[model samples]
Target: MQEALRLNKPVLAICRGMQILNVAMGGTLIQDILELWGGSIKHFREELPEHMPAHTVDLCGEKITEIMGKEKIDVNSFHHQAIDRLGTGLLCTGISPDKIIETVEAPGYFWVIGVQWHPELMFNYFEEQHNLFKSLVTKCLENMP
Candidate 1:
């Protein structure tokens, strides 16, 4: 992440990748969800994987909302880990009702963005979700110097 940021490269981090970026940028994590939240609430079901539903997320009305053109988005939840302390130059742009950090961004810096859920997995099932990749491609193209 430091390398990418130093190079001014466009980045779209997903899941663990987002966590890595945050950690690299002097951020921290909750470590254990069950420990922090005080319960073994399964965020992802391994057996009935297909039972995943589109959950609502609150967009912080920043560049992310401008790019995606919406204040709310339906996304899939998978991981138990989440962003606790935001990184430098990073902004939390989306969250679940449970207050999980759903998305983050470094706006106006070559499309530096991240999402907690798996948009790639919902591509076939949701057009809006797939548009994220499409948007990233467009941003990458625009950022090319």
Candidate 2:
């Protein structure tokens, strides 16, 4: 992930990938959301439908708001770990109602976004989730020499 960022490659990290991306950028994770950061919303929803919107994420970043087409969006939650300290150069773009970091973006890169939710599973139900990939692909193509 660091290599991709250094190369200015578009990186769309989802679920555990978001955790990995954070660590790769010198940030830390909660390890377990329930154990460390207790909240009303359950971060690990293995029993629920993967495509179902588990909770809402309030967004702030201009890029994310534009991509999502709204200030808040429903997303599926499937992981227990979440970003604690933001990685170097990474901006906290989205947050759950419980205050868990839901989305992050590296401003220095062309398109480096890490989403805590499983957008891949929700794409069939949410157009905004699908647009995440479309945005990444569009950035990738734009960067190609």
Candidate 3:
């Protein structure tokens, strides 16, 4: 992630990938979002259903909203840890109802976005989620030699 970021390469990190990106960029994680944020809604829910629209992530900034084509998106969550202190140059693109970091991006760079949800899992059931994959692939292809 650091190398890709240094080279301004196109990359999309998901869930724990986002956590790794944060740690690589001198940021921190909640460790256990469930235990730390137990007061909030059941973010670490178990056995509800696979690929169900779990929570709404309110997207911020014109870039993310434009890419997602909405101010908010329903995403399926599956991780216990999340970003706490944001990575350097990475902006908080979206957040959950309980204020968990749902999306992030490296501003002034190429496609270096990260999301806490599994858009790949949701892409089959929800057509809107496919845009995330499409966006990543499009960016990657654009940067290819």
Candidate 4:
């Protein structure tokens, strides 16, 4: 990650990958949600009713909002870990209302975005999620020079 950052590469980190990015850059994690939230609130409802929406995330008015062009996005969650202390040069770009860090980015670098939710799972369910990948690819291509 540091190598990619040094090279000004575009990055799209998902779930644990996002957490790893944060830690690699000096961030802290919430560790365990069940203990923090004091309930059996399952982040991943893999067996839940199909009609139920998994979770929602609020996009901060910074990098993510600029890229996604939205204030809020409903996303699927399947992680127990989250960012607590933000890393150096990193800013929160999205969050769960419960204060869980859903996304972060270092605008100092080129096209670096991280999300706690799994956008890959929502690619077909939401066009915006697909657009996220398209945008990342475009940025990566543009930054290849």
Please name the candidate that would achieve the greatest TM-score relative to the true structure: 2
Clashes (backbone N, CA, C under 3 Å), per candidate, total 0, 0, 0, 0
* Residue-by-residue lDDT tens digits, candidate 2, 1-145: 7788778888989888989999999999998889898879998888999898889999998888888899999999998888999888899999999999999988887888889998889888899998898888888899898
Ranking by TM-score: 2, 3, 4, 1
Question: How do the residues 64-109 of candidate 3 rate in per-residue lDDT, one tens digit apiece?
Answer: 6777888879888788888989877778989999999999888778
Which segments of model 3 are wrong by more than 4 Å? none
lDDT of each: 0.78, 0.90, 0.83, 0.80
- Candidates 1 and 3 compared: the better one by TM-score is 3
Error of 2 at 23 (Å): 0.8
Model 4 clash tally?
0
> Which lDDT value does model 1 have at 126?
67
Each prediction's RMSD over C-alphas, in Å, is: 2.2, 0.9, 1.3, 2.2
Q: Model 2, poorest ten-residue lDDT window?
A: 1-10
Q: Best candidate per lDDT, number?
A: 2
Error of 4 at 113 (Å): 0.3
